[model samples]
Target: MTQGVMSGAGCACQPVEAVTAETFARSWSGVSALAWRVPLLAWALLVVAWSGASFWGPPEMWFLYMTHWGLLFILLEMVFGVIVAAVKTPEKNPDEESGLPWYVRVYWLLYNITIPVAFLITIFYWCILKPASKNTHVNYAPNPVLDVMLHGVNSVAMLVELALSRHPSRLLDVVQPWVFASVYMFFTLIYFFAGGLDPWGNAFIYPVVDWSKPEQTAVVITLTGLFLTLMHLATIGLASLRDRLIRRCRRDSAGVYNEGFTA
Candidate 1:
């Protein structure tokens, strides 16, 4: 009878109701729990095994490298998040007050933000930095399996959880990334002045941070900071987009039209 309605559609063509945020969240509550726990369990198993087999007797300071530190942060986040989710899921209420102190909350934020950072770091290193530095770098044979699991899968699982799970809100506290980046920036400065030697035998952990060329190092730092900021914003935007896209898709499949959405 109507352009949007099927010719054989009877009274079943009544207007469809819009799915609100709360409804969407409730629908995915069980999914969110499973999504986070699954990857977290995998991360714990892989890292623990990797540490035991490969890092049993390595230099203690080798743990200070950003890549290693990032892994630790990611692991901590997963473990703690799973434990807390067991106690009470975020789907319960994101704004709900936790009796925990401010420092603990800060820890949560860092790990949450670290997920995308970890992924972006690996992407930059493998896709661009590694290629450009090959001429000036020494070649070494390493296990590609663990490398992908660490660099690629670690980052991706976190994001997958985000896409599959529903957050209370799409607007994350945007300032959290700045704080996380600042703390690491402070660490880099400490390593620089303290004569910290990286596992690579260089004074700087990252090749880009090598101080021999002041001009290049400065450019690297500035560009890196900019990139981090941009990425943080991009991830936040993705959260919003993911929420809107999923909702719109569900509504369309159900023959529902959202007033806020346009074809």
Candidate 2:
């Protein structure tokens, strides 16, 4: 039931069936698997190093933040992606879409959740958090480098992966991200009640997320959930557009080859 099955018309909007092992192992560009694996490996290492350094520095409390959690997701996604491409075996019939391997499905699930959440973290920080911090004279970003890496590079990497990966986006995948967001909101409530503090020693994790102001916090959560839904929809649309463009290009190229051969 979870398998992506295309209709007779090859509708790009339908969830795609599990693809070939090679497709899972390589990029949409048809590049060598090493070409895909090496970059992911390097970035994974970088994420590990940065995370270690961040923890080692002052105010380790920042680890409690959602941006850092997003970083963790990025690292996990890359590591699992490398493993899948390296060790995943082909199905009995390469042409058939029985279903993805369990690990492959997990990796796809991470990709779906990670990408939009990364963007959400970035958007919320720069647009909402940073501006509010400015007026309050609070320093949300203690380190400029870490600031850009977490808020900027995370989303950029997700964008690059989106363009390169062969995996199809499922509209149903949005539920996974929504559930993840709900978990984090629940955590915030617990953290607040338990007397957790932001790095600056405030009672709330973020200035805008004041538990004492329940109405404001509720509005923030509701808006954030809506934005996440929109982001996932946008992700699906991008994948569909990429598929349509690739199919059109292949058809045109095949037509050109046939015309030349017959002439």
Candidate 3:
């Protein structure tokens, strides 16, 4: 072959991989992923930045709290979600959703489960629950920003994310809420038994989990479990409804296209 022809052929033979437009763009794999993820992630990151900055006292105390746990979980899901959306390579199995890692998937379920649980904490602590028994829980100076983040924004963000994100929800997903609540319950018991102290140096993390009253603790947990179960069921119902509506719309569009073709 001529030298010029050989050089041209070699250049042409090298494979050039085409990068997708979304490769560098941050987006969600699911349809409404961006609508929900951006706000949820931004809110969680705000809280995380403040917490990491030592705004809420020692990291030791903040990390141990349930509020912080939920916050971190939100941030984790959002961060990992963006990563999976951008970096995941499509496989032969189109059935798979988001190609989320096992850890991220687990946390995703936990995040859905923890939504109501976090709100329960917020409603009780920030509402009249704290006032009814003021001496029991920690009495930190009020910061409206932190208060809103803890009690109000957390649940609101989750609900908003739910509205924007599309995912299949099944009855089996009920286990998620139980698993989350059980973990915190177990931790509370362990903390009680181990003599762990709260931010104010109290034995129990929440004033309600008194070591002296095991029966009361059991009752409280049982009630919480019931509430969580109800909430989980409601989530399933809504998800199922959404799926049906989407399918119906697609079917109708297909029918319209066929009619047009026939005409």
Candidate 4:
């Protein structure tokens, strides 16, 4: 009778141990999968496609000039840094991996400052210099497909960064969307102003809208911008909320398991 009781207790413990090990393995596997699916690669591919298409496609000079080079620089900086880092120091712990390295952090700091500087430069070109040059041919209407691709890449990058980063506080999530919207709004204003001043200015640049009149253009641009801004805010808010809830549930489950084990 004593031997049988001991044997039953050992069997129960073995199953519990097996289950804990399985759970740990699955968690590790998930972390590994997330590391492999880096969002920067997707952004790089999109940049490459956009740049290649600009070279081969119709002569949308302004679109090609701004987007092709801008994206190239951004993508080159991001992708090169990540690839080199991966080759040199592949992350052993995927759960603790981060998208922003030291260099990337510095780069973003500079990028944030340079945005206002770039906007000032654009203002100088459009408001002061372009008025005298007599070249009233500003074409602000970019290809809708390309715009979609670019913004889509940006959205994916944001989400992936949110997922991979260790300290995903609510503050970061709340501020990011507003920052994005503000930058976009600034660019849109510049583009619209420049396009409006041009003699060949057309409202619809890429068949996405009929920007035939000033009022019509305003309505379209304002509505679209508002909608996208709201969407971005909602996406980040929901993702962060979901992450927090899931983490809390996992902690609760683990606590219960530990208590039960102690009992």
Q: In candidate 3, what residue range of length 10 has the lowest lDDT sum?
A: 254-263
Angstrom error of the Cα, residue 254, model 4: value is 11
Pick by lDDT: 1 or 4, better one:
1
**Candidate 2 lDDT tens digits, 41-127:** 587578657755765335567566788778878888887787777785655533234455666666777888998998899999999
What digit string (tens of lDDT, one per residue) describes model 1 on residues 1-263? 22232112222233433322222222243444534565676776787468546642345754655566667777666665555444432333343354333333543475457765776677767875667657654321155676676667767866765565443221234356556666776787787788877656667656666766678878877777677666765665665577557656666444222221111
Query: How high is the lDDT of residue 140 in model 4?
Result: 35
Query: 103-216, model 4: which lDDT tens digit per residue?
Result: 434333332322222233233334433354354344332465554454344444544543443221222232343454456445545655566322244433322223346576
TM-scores of all predicted structures: 0.70, 0.82, 0.71, 0.41
* N/CA/C clash count, model 1: 0
lDDT string, candidate 3, 1-263, tens digits:
11111121132122222222232122123353555566677878988887667544566676666667777777877775555444553434432444434444654565566556666666656764457446654654257677677767877876655444444344555677687778878888888888887767777666666666889778777877787777666565654455446546554321000000110
Q: What's model 3's overall lDDT? A: 0.57
**Reference-based lDDT, residue 260, model 2:** 9
TM-score of 3: 0.71
On TM-score, the stronger of 2 and 4 is 2
Candidate 2 clashing pairs, residues 3+ apart or interchain: 4-16, 4-17
